[model samples]
Target: MGNEYRIALAGNPNTGKSTLFNALTGLRQHTGNWAGKTVSLAQGSVEYKNKTFQFIDLPGTYSLFSNSKDEEVARNYIVFEKPDVTLVVLDATSLERNFNLALQVLEMTKNVIICINLIDIAEKQGIEIKERLLTNRLGVPVIKISARNKIGFPLLLDTIDRIVTGAIECQPLVLQYPDEIEEKIRQIEPHVRAIVGDHVSARWVALRLLDGDESLLDEINRLITLKGAS
Candidate 1:
C-alpha cells in the first residue's frame, strides 16, 4: 500500500471534483455505490513521477456535520481510511461558501491540498482568489486549477507527489471554536482519545460529540461497551 499513494478527493457539490478525477485518471476509472448507501464513489489511478496515485472521489457534500448519506460517506472515509492526502476541490467562484467543507476536512485530517478549481469561471465572473493569502490563512498548499480545461495539473500532480513522498510538509490550520465549546472539547478529548486510540483526531471527535453527532456517539459507546465486555 505504501508503494502507491492513496488520495481522497473531497469537496462541495458542483466543485468539479469528478471533473478533476476524470482529468487526472482520464480513462482509468471505475464507479460503485458506497456499501449500504445509494451514494456513489469513483476511484481512479494515475501514474506520476514514477509513483502510482490512487484517487477516491467521495460524494459531494456541503458540510460533514450534516446527517446526509453523502456527508457521512465523505466524513467516514477521511476519518477511517486516512488517505495519504485529501485533495479538497473548491469552486473558485464561491470559495467562501465552499471553505466551510474544507475547514471541516482540515479538522479531521492534517494532510490536505486545497484545489481552487473553476478558475476560468471565476475569471469570467470577475472573481479572483489571492492564492498566497488563502494559502497563508489555511496553512496548506493551495493549487489553482481549471479542472475542466486541465490547467495547472502539472503543478497539482507535482505538489501531490511531493507531499506523498514527504518532500513537502503540511501543517494545516485547525479551527478554533468559542471559548465554552473549546472548554467542552478539552474535557471530551481525553475520553475520545482513550476510545479511538489515535485512529482519528480526538479533537475532531470531541467537536462531533459537542455537535451531537449520533453516529460517532454510538460508535464510541459501542467501543466502550466492547472494552468493558473484554
Candidate 2:
C-alpha cells in the first residue's frame, strides 16, 4: 500500500481540538483507547488532492511532561511512532499558555504544524496574533483556522500535503536559553544524536535533559536503543 500520512492532533484542553477533529473527518473516525491504556484515541481519514491522511486525535493535555496515563499515551505516540505530522491545535486567545505545549512538541520532532484555533474568538476579545510574525519566529508554517467555522483548512491540508510529500521542510521552533543552558544542550546533543533517529532534533532533546526531564530522556534513549536493535 502507498504511504498514508499519519497526523496527531494535540494541544491543551478545550481548545476546540475535538471539534476540529470532527470537522475534519466528520463521522468517519475509528475510536478506541490507546494501546494498553484507557485514554481514548480517535483515528480517521481525510483525503485532499487525491492524497490520504490518517488523523490521530491525542488526548487533550496541558503538557507532555505529565505522570497521568492520558498524557503518557499522547507523549509516547509522538516520540515513538513519529507520525508524519503533528498538528498542534492551540487557542489563539491564550497563546502563552498554549505555547508551553507547542514548545514541548518542538523538542520531539520537526514535522509540526501549529494550528492557531479560535482566531475568531481572539478577534472578538481584541487579541490579535501576528500570524506572519509567529510563523517567522517558529520557522514553521502557521495556518490560522477557526475549526468550528472551518477557516483556512484548504490551505492547512495543502500544507500537510507538502509536509508529508517532503516538498517542504518543517522548521520547528527551537527556542534559545541562557548561555549555560546552551552549553548543556551542546554537551548532550552528541550523545542524543548517536542514539536517536535523524528525524528528531537532538538539540531539542538536549534542552529537555538540562531541565532534568527523566521521562523524556529515558524515552528517547529507549527509542534509540530499539532503533539500534532493529
Candidate 3:
C-alpha cells in the first residue's frame, strides 16, 4: 500500500474487518487519533490505478452503540470528521447486526460504500443475500468482495473514487427507533452545535448522547465550560 489518499473503514467487531483492511493497504498502515476523540484511528495507503488510496481503520464495534469506546470513535469520524468516504465493511453472514451499524452510518453522513465480505462462508451455510435487493435497499454502490481472494478490488476502488469525487451520492435510510428514544434524540439535537458543526447531523450526536456515551458527554461538558468562559 503506497499512495497519497485518505479513507475510513468502519464496521462492527470480529467481522474479518482487520484482515480486509490489511489486504487493502498492506504494509502502509499507521495509527493515530480521530482529531478530537482519544479513540485510536489506523490508516494506510494503496496505489489504485495511479490514484493513492488512504484508509482509516476504525475500531470494530456492534452497531453505533455509544456505550463503548470503539463506537464513539467510528461514529465521531463519520459525524464530525466527515471523511472523504466511509466504507461500512460488513460480514455477509451476519447481515442483521452488521447492517445495524451500516444503517446508522448512513443516517450520519452521505459518503458510504458497503463491503459484504465472507460470502464464501455464507454460501456454505446455505444463506443467500440477494445482492441486488440489498443494493436497491442501500441506495449506494454495493460491492461483494472477498478481500482474501481479491475478487472485487477493482470495483471497490472505482466505487471509492466515485464516492470521494461526489459523483455518487450515498443516502441513508431513516430508521425509526423506539418512540421514547426518538423523542430524546429530537430534544438533544439542538444542543450539539457548540461542540460540532453543520457538516454533521445533529440528530445522530443526540442519539449517541441518549445512549450514554461518556466521551461525548465529556466533549459537550468541555464545550459548555468554554462557552461559560467566553
Candidate 4:
C-alpha cells in the first residue's frame, strides 16, 4: 500500500456509513471478515492530493463495549491497529442517540473526524444540527454531509487531507468519570503508561481495565508486545 493512511469508518447501523465508504473508495474495495470471526470488514483505497487513503468500514454497532461479535471486531481493530483517523458517522436526525458511540470513540483516540450523515432527512424532519457547537463540544472537526446524495463530500475530503497532512490539529474532548473512579484511573494510569508507552492512551487503558474488558485487555497486551518488538 506504500504508506497509505488508514481511515476507519465507525458508526451505528443505518447511519449511511457504508454509502460514504463506497463514494470515497469507488471501485477499489474488498469485503471480508476479521480473522476467526464472522463480523464483516470492508476495506477500500482512494487517492487524494497525491496520497493514498485506505478506508475500513467497521461493522455497525450501537456501542463498542457491547458483547456482540461485531462490536468485538470494531473495537479491537480500532484499539490495536490504531488507524490514522477514525471517521465517526453520526445520524443528524438522532444526534443524541448516535452521539453515544462518538463519545466512546473519543475516549479511545484523539484523531477523530465526525461526519453528520443524513442531513437531508434531518432537514426534512426539521431537525437541524449545529455543526460548530458539536465541533467545539467534541473538540474535533464535524462535517455535515448527505452521503446518499454526495453532498458536502468535497469539503469532507479537504478536511481529511488537511488532518492527515498535519495542517489541521485535533485535540479530542476528554470524558470525566466519577470521583472514585477517577481516583482509581489516576492510580492505574502510571502502570498502563509504563507498559504501553503512549502506543495508546493510558486513560483509555485504565478505563478498559476498570470495565473488566478482558478481551480488549488481551489485545492491548498483544499490541504492547508488538510495539516492544518493533
Candidate 5:
C-alpha cells in the first residue's frame, strides 16, 4: 500500500464537481451518510504516482455559512476533519460566480487547489481566463480542465500530487474586511485560539461567532466538552 492522503472536493451545484469526482474515482467509489448527519457524501480512492488519494465529494454549497443542513455538513467536514488538501472545482464559463465558494474555502484552509473545469466550453464561448494571473492573485495553483473530456487530468493529478507531497506550497488569499469587523475579529480570535488551541482555524471560528452562527457555537461547545471529558 502507498501513502494515503485525504482530499475534500467542494464546489457549487452544476460546476461539474460530480463529473470530476466520477472521473477520478471511476467505479471505485461509495456513497454514505456522514456521521450523525443525514447528509450523504460520495467517497472514492484513486492511485497516483504510487500514492493513494481518497476524495470526499462534499455537498454542493454556495457558501459555507451553515444556512442549510448540506451547507453545515460541508462546512463541518472542512473545519473539523481538516483534509490534507481541498480541491475546489469551478466552472470556467462562470468563474465569477464560482469564485464565491472558492474564496470561502480559502479562508478556511490554506491547503487548497482551484480546478477550473469546462475550459474548452469557456473558450468556445470566447471566455478567456488568465490562469497565471489567477494563480498570482489567489496564491494557489489553478489548473484548467474539461472533466467531461478528461482534458488536463494529467496536470490536475500532478498538481494534487505536488500539494500532497509538499512539493508545492499554497499561501491562500486572505480577504480584508471593514475596520470594524477586523477589530472584532482581532478581539475574539485570541479567545477562540485559547480554547481550540490550533485544533481548528481560530480566526474562522471568530468570524462565525461574529456572524452569530449558533450552529457553529454549539459545535465548538460540544468539541470543548468532549475534550474536557477526554
Candidate 6:
C-alpha cells in the first residue's frame, strides 16, 4: 500500500469549508453519518506528490464544547482519531469570530495549520491580514487562500505535505487561563496523563473536567474500560 495521511477539515459554517473540500476531492467523496450519531460527515481522498491525503470534513461547528451533536462529533474525532494534521479553515472577513474555534483546536493538538479562506472577499473589503504576523502569533503555518478561486492551493498542498512528512514542525499557541483555573488544571492534568498516557491531550481533558463536562467523564471511563478489556 502507498503512504496515506489523514487530515481533518474543521471550520465554522459558511466559511467556504465545504467548497474547499469539494474542490480538492471532486467526485472522490462520500457523505455518511458518524457512528451512533445522525450528524453527517463527508470524507474524500486526493493524491498529492505521490501521497494519498484522506480528508475527513468534520461537521461545521463554531465551538467544540459539545453543546450540540455536531460539536460532539467534531470534538470527539479530533480528540480521539488524532488525525495526522488538522486544517482549520477560517474566514478572513470575520477572523475574530472564527478564532474561537481555532484556539480550541490548538489546545487539543499541536499538529495544526490555520488556513485563512475567503481572502479575496476580505481584500475587496479593504482588509489586509498580516499572514506572517498571524503565523508567528499562532505558532503554526497560516496560509491565506481563496478556495473558490483555487488561489494559493499549491502552497496549501505543499504546506500540508511538509507537515505530514515532518519537514515542518507545528508549535501551536498554548492558551493561558486564570490563575485559579491554572492551579486546578495543574492538579488534574497529572491524573489525566496517567490515565490517557499520551493517547490524548491531558491538559485539554483536564480543562473539560474542570468545566463539569459529564459527557467527557463518561468518555474517560469508557476509554479506561476499553483499555482494560484490551
TM-scores for every candidate against the unseen true structure: 0.91, 0.88, 0.82, 0.92, 0.96, 0.96
Root-mean-square deviation of every model: 2.5, 2.3, 3.6, 2.1, 1.4, 1.5
* Candidate 2 C-alpha RMSD relative to the actual structure: 2.3
| Local accuracy of candidate 2 as per-residue lDDT tens digits, 1-230 | 36678899999999989989999999778987665455678899998877788899988999887568678788888976788899999998889999999988987878889999999999999998888898888878888999999998898999999998889797776678889888888888898787674756678667667777788766666766766799
lDDT per prediction?
0.88, 0.84, 0.77, 0.88, 0.91, 0.92
Q: Candidate 6: where is the Cα deviation over 4 Å?
A: 32-40
Instruction: Show where candidate 4 strays beyond 4 Å.
Output: 1-3, 32-40, 224-230
Write model 4 residue lDDT over 1-230, tens digit each, in one string. Answer: 55579899999999999999998888999986666556668999988888888899998999999478789888887876789899999999888999999999999888899999999999999987889998898889999999999999888888888888889899999998899999999999999899888777889889988999898877776766766799
**How much lDDT does candidate 5 score?**
0.91
Candidate 2 residue spans exceeding 4 A from truth: 32-40, 197-199, 217-230
Give me the displacement of residue 66 in model 5, in angstroms: 0.4
Model 6, global lDDT: 0.92
- What is the Cα-based lDDT of residue 119 in candidate 1? 95
Candidate 4's TM-score: 0.92
| Top-down lDDT ranking | 6, 5, 4, 1, 2, 3
User: Which model scores highest in lDDT?
Assistant: 6
RMSD of 6: 1.5
Q: Where does candidate 4 clash, by residue pair?
A: none
TM-score: which is higher, 3 or 6?
A: 6
lDDT value, candidate 1, whole model: 0.88
**What is the number of backbone collisions in each predicted candidate, taken in the order shown?**
0, 0, 4, 0, 0, 0
Q: In model 4, state the lDDT of residue 32.
A: 68
Stronger candidate by lDDT (2 vs 6): 6
Which of 3 and 5 is the better model by lDDT? 5
Off by over 4 Å in 1: 32-40, 220-230
Task: Report the backbone clash tally of model 4.
Answer: 0
